[model samples]
Target: MQREGRRDSWEEEIKENSSAVERVLKLVEEDAVVLFSKSGCCISVAAKALLSTLGAHPTVHQLDKEKEGEEMEGALLTMLAAPPAVPAVFIGGKLVGGMEQLMSCHITGSLLPLLKEAGALWF
Candidate 1:
């Protein structure tokens, strides 16, 4: 019984520490390019790939159904209300919609310019 209690306490501590670390990381990336995605989403994958190909290393926030709890869901909802979708990109704390919008910007030769304007890229 004592061993089981100890194990449970250890698990709780680990969870708390992990949450704290995540919060710290979120704050550390001041000019963050956040991609709210999930595994097995083709659009999200392509969006991430596009960012990488453009020489931008975005902080990918995988919102797995099993892992997303109230806090995360609430945050997402507050930021992007109505019909929440994957691959939602937030560049320097600004929401920049999904892959379709990205593709449009790319075709117009405007995406890179926008990144530069946002100071997210050094070119």
Candidate 2:
């Protein structure tokens, strides 16, 4: 049986994670394209480069540099149901998945339309 104190602590953790999720949601909404990333993460670097190359100006949050970065990253993974990874991309407030998914979209020729629809691209 779990002690009352233990249960309370668990609940607190959930609340904290939820709050982080909320912050991420707000940040994602602030731009047409947002990338939740870690500054030193190679995958994140690749993701940013890919978006830039495609002429999409993505607003990137280097979670590792934020106050609750690790927590926010964990919350994003949970909220988006994405793999545990940095460089989670959102297009017009919609989860666009990570690098692999983004590359797939680009290869399939669907990324440009999404960028344009999100107003990240004009032409």
CA lDDT scores, all candidates in order = 0.65, 0.84
Please write out the lDDT profile of model 1 over residues 1-123, one tens digit for every residue: 986886676566446556543542363256556777777888888998898799777777676743543345344443443345566776766677777777888899978876776666766
Winning model by lDDT: 2
Per-residue lDDT, model 2, residue 63, is: 88
- What tens-digit string does per-residue lDDT give for candidate 2 at 1-88? 5567766665665577888878888888899999988868899889889999989979989988999898888777665554665779
Candidate 2: where are CA atoms >4 Å away? 1-16
Q: Which one wins on TM-score?
A: 2
For every candidate in turn, the CA RMSD to the true structure comes to 12.0, 5.8
Residue 54 error for model 2, in Å?
1.0
Which pairs clash in model 2? none
